[model samples]
Target: MTVPGSAPTPPDPFAPARLGPLTLRNRVIKSATFEGVTPEGLVTDELIAYHRRPAAGGVGMTTVAYCAVSPEGRTERHQIWMRPEAVPGLRRLTDAVHREGAAVSAQIGHAGPVADARSNRLPALAPGRFLSPLGMRMTRAATAEDIARVIRAHAAAARIAVESGFDAVEMHFGHNYLASSFLSRRLNHRDDAYGGSLANRAEVALGIARAVRDEVGDTIAVTAKLNMDDGVPGGFWLDESLQVARRLQEEGTVDALELTAGSSLLNPMYLFRGEAPLSEFAAVFPRPMRLGIRLAGRRFLHAYPYEEAFLLPSARQFRAALSLPLILLGGITRRATVERAMAEGFEYVAMARALLREPDLVNRMAEDRDVRSLCIHCNKCMPTIYTGTHCPLVGPLAGPPAPPLTGDGGRPRPHAS
Candidate 1:
């Protein structure tokens, strides 16, 4: 599993590593980069082909981006819907990746208030009524019954992952989504058992994890993409996140944790700042792009351009606090960075934009030790995703429309025109 042309003195990046119950061939992971490749909430040929390229490229595992448990909770127009009928296409996707010697995982979640019901024509549910950053008014607090339904949906989705030949299921518990929104004091204003105290705030995430574990048992891996800091005042921070991680680990509800940051509502730029123009995105944001950019010069932002592995420090800190396997994600794009993460105690390193830039990056890295990625961190890939298009920076192969998954067991038909 050693990368092909790398120096013999350099350690093999593709060697086997344990992730929960599954042992991956390497520490190189194709992180969840949204491809907008799933058409009509089903696994399309384009999605399968896009994922298989990475598997063939040599990543130990590939994670499908953002599978919605319920249609009302989707993040995009073409997000995969975890339903009984969608399992066959998902199985095909996983099988394709597996044939290339890489394991596959599905990221499952509910978008909650972050989604635009006006666009999807679905009801946006949250813990409380709040004005969304997009200027939409979120209505209706999640009732106890609603909470139960969401939890069941997560469990059902996990079951589908198992049946669909997925080796793992990564729970979306970050980025101000359903579970993350509940953990935020500014978002969850309810006085019930599901809100207020830290324990109460974590109840929904804990319940979702428990349900997924119960449904999937010990065979398939259960991982969570957790936000250590939402990068906003009064939002979920490291101390509380660490506590939640510890509790979940003790409960045996999650096998690994992928550390991420920022609330999409308060700071969408933080998650994908590279995509937006410096002036345009920052002007709309509450905080300054840099603390002293006004006093200093523009040289500061240019010096430290947000690239892959930007969240390594947070990942390292979490690794120090817990013995659970940690997957370092963010702007990981180079071999040196990947090696550094492993040396710094991260069990695995995941890449999104880099993979989007070149689906065969793993293979390229394997065949040529000196190969550097072409993903300039321009983040042109982000906006097109909303319209169900591939990355724009990826040349002709990029931006291809997702091929439809036909047959009755394919994707759910689109409700909108």
Candidate 2:
């Protein structure tokens, strides 16, 4: 049943709720963000620690970010790949999270044309050929055979996700990745069966959903992170996304929809607003890209003002349109915004930067009932993914903190509130 639009008694964000086949302790989910801990696509102690800390801190579910279905599908070589050998390490990670009282999920996806050839050392694939800004090379338009293989690869990865003891799996259908690239009319220029009209572009997404559902069945819940708007003028917008959402709902493949916006390829700042750390971002790249950033840094690291519940305005349109539960992502910091999200009919709130800033922010809120996040939304944490994902003001990943945090192995600050 859908949560009513009319405020149905503001819910305690801490209360447990049902999400598909699983029941979460709360409506809070850790939105997937790249963890630069793994090397060679294998889970390391640091990788497990990264997720395990949040799980222990308190989240309904913690999603391991941007796991590739195949090796070449990865954005970087260190990103986890779904395979038999990967299962054991993943199992260990999931077991750790589960022990922390939070269910774990895997964000499975293909970087496609977003794959960095310079970093991952692999040619990028997309719905149509184009020059890649990151890869610095011409991308290969996926052949029909390649498309079929990628679809199957996602299904095969779902099976591994289940084997690895994940409570749920989220297909990454946003951020101009493989499936999202197809949705963007600006990106997908092919006239084949998989391109041109909106329906054709949507086929690959639906196919992936059905294929993954078939593999996982009722054993684990299936979720999708879909774009509400690509945030680029010519990209996939809300009107088209609503149709895709309705289709996914009708197809019975996805149990919940996590709505996000912006294209990592086009308008990245659309996804994470606030101060755009241009020089910090430029530092991560090689000399060639660094030189390019020095010339066009402002355009590349576009700035958007930060606001709590930043996605609520756009996501509410979806809440009125679809009955399937919606998970709102973006700028979810303080308890007020979370309550606001629930009051507005959003079933769950997914947080990224807030959680990164305070891994135990949920627990801190639970204790104080009024604790607020300290994330300034400088967006410097974004470039940290190239080396390590951490907040500049918090944690061991970014150096000494002004005042240490309480959870995720940081020194306790009982007076944090």
Candidate 3:
């Protein structure tokens, strides 16, 4: 994808870079921020239009945020299910981004225990039977058959992603999802091969990665968003995650790694740090959840001070230990930070909220290096994902009252940072 006679590259951030089979125009990627625009697990014009602005603005690539591998894996009823039927709408999204000079990637994943039973109208699945405080339901433990089904679902999603014109597929292994849950000692209590040791716990994730590579070959790039820490007391952490990344590198299942931390079910606030929109969240949910949220929302949506390139410290850990290219996420709002990342050996930086606030931020940065994003880090945007992921601070996705979550993929992607 090429921008039409665009201005010359800046010293660092604007340099052309190649990730796997895709050659990007620059180092910035519009990271996967779940756009709750899909109404029936189908893509909408609003979703397509939502990404085009960033593509035109100047991001080297834009990820079509989390797409479930199966209906059972969706976090909500309206999320796109990665099946043959989803190909047409997905193609439309990819086509739109490509036209604006950006490569497109689909973040494919299974929400696993993070799946909501009340919203999905289906029993949630987990490594072991447990009750989710978030979904407020008794979840089902995945049987051997269920395990096999999810693995195959990931491969099928990758094949469909290629058919739908995606240049890359991001395997979602972070945020306490199916693969991540297996890694959690507190979650995976299975006596079977898929659960005992750390290596065994990671078996499900490794299998899915291999299966995806076996299906897609080099037709598209495979990236994995792996967790460095689960942010819970007894959850997955960096030491174990580094070992997993090494195994993936040896197996050659992924092309790049995007590091993330947090548990969608527990310690949810770890992903995007700033103010916790407790009042906003309470207002968005049903009457049943409103009371529960009002009483304990503070713990669920805890706040952390925002710092530019807040994740660099974690990402640098992966860069020092691995040879594969890495994409730094979280608090990447300025060009100087992007330059710091590049100089430090990180190949790219992924932006979610900043891009949401200003789709043209990349273009503005290219024209003027000192440009700073207007995002306040208030995190009011978190609740808005359900209403179609707009930035309330400014821009089109902002200001529209957050409706309900109506909020809200894969690879052998071993991740770091």
Candidate 4:
């Protein structure tokens, strides 16, 4: 009898590990699930509390999600964009997480076609013109000048992250964002140097990674969340993605690669395999958009069955193809899975929904080797991104919406901010 992909006694998942220049307490990282608490494109006390809970709960590192590289790169107006004005608040957030004894990383990227043009009041750029259902408009095809600007923006974002005291910066190259858009043959129809061939298409992602590394120079560990597959027919699939991963490994700019899947543009649910919360998602948008979602949500949010370590099979390909450190994401729910990832040679394991369901789960897992996560994979938390991201099955955020607190010594103030 043979244990599949078995190796020598696996390193303890709870042991300290080095990621580039920083030493993390353990091998587990809290994957970035866009915290919707930053309503003014700046940090809020709510945002700090959101990250603090997981750090205190015992993640080796807690990632602050979707810090856009520029104003126009944001998915919507409320998302945080890296800027000098944003640093002080980010500094406070980093400090809070540091007090919990966990390193913090900022996940930065340009949303591109994923950007909501109506809410951002700015044109969203894509590799080629495409109809954006979320913004109800056609995305503008990115120009050469626009590409240069976005590349510079990534470097600037990394500098800001360093100044704000982030221990790591995970460049977002997944989920059909700006760089990921260029990688897709189905989306990038341009005849320019930045399109057609895989190498040309990869120029954007490679350039951004090099620029970011040049700007920060190991001051903070640089990692990238890269798509292993886009999950759309004729999109960026494994064959091309393996080559892209090889190039990233060759460049040696990123310290580690966190492998992910799904297209935020065409197939958002592929990344998080489980029940698609269609009704909950529809409830968050305006009536017109809600109607659209009700009509078409199933097509976009196609459900995939839940399983333990869902991405491990694909991640194993990367592990086999490249020597760069790999973070296995998707369906990481229990201590056994983390151990499984380690046994298979993955450097770290990242979790989002599980930590959201029970913030103290890592600590609990440390105490009990057989511990399992409480997340039911219902994904009701998916729709909460528009309001405040929380698992509806647990804690204060659960149940019916509470009435807003009154101002003026508990008397209802007619015009409260």
Please give, for residues 216-322, the per-residue lDDT of candidate 1 as tens digits.
Answer: 88889899988888877788888999999998888988888888887766665566546444442233223542334244422212223585578876777788889
Q: lDDT of each prediction vs. the true structure?
A: 0.75, 0.83, 0.82, 0.86
Candidate 4 has an lDDT of 0.86
Error of 4 at 398 (Å): 10
Give the TM-scores of the predictions, in the order they appear.
0.85, 0.92, 0.92, 0.93
- Cα shift from native, residue 142, model 4 (Å): 1.1
How far is 224's C-alpha from truth in model 4 (Å)? 0.3
Q: Write the per-residue lDDT of candidate 3 for residues 1-417, one digit (tens) a residue.
A: 337896433336676778888888898998888877776678888889888979988999999877899887887666788988888999999998999999999998888888877777787789899897656788899888988899999999999999999999999889888899999998989999888899999998998899999999998999999988898898998999999988889899999889889888887778888888888777876678689888988877778888998877877888999998888998988878887788788888899888888899998988888998888998887777656677876745533333333322110010111
Which one is best on lDDT?
4
- Misplaced by over 4 Å in model 3 are 1-11, 287-291, 395-417
Q: Write the per-residue lDDT of candidate 2 for residues 16-42, one digit (tens) a residue.
A: 999999999999999898877665578
lDDT of 1 at 64: 88
| Model 2 stretches astray by more than 4 angstroms | 1-7, 286-291, 397-417
Candidate 1: misplaced stretches above 4 Å? 1-12, 278-304, 386-389, 396-399, 402-417
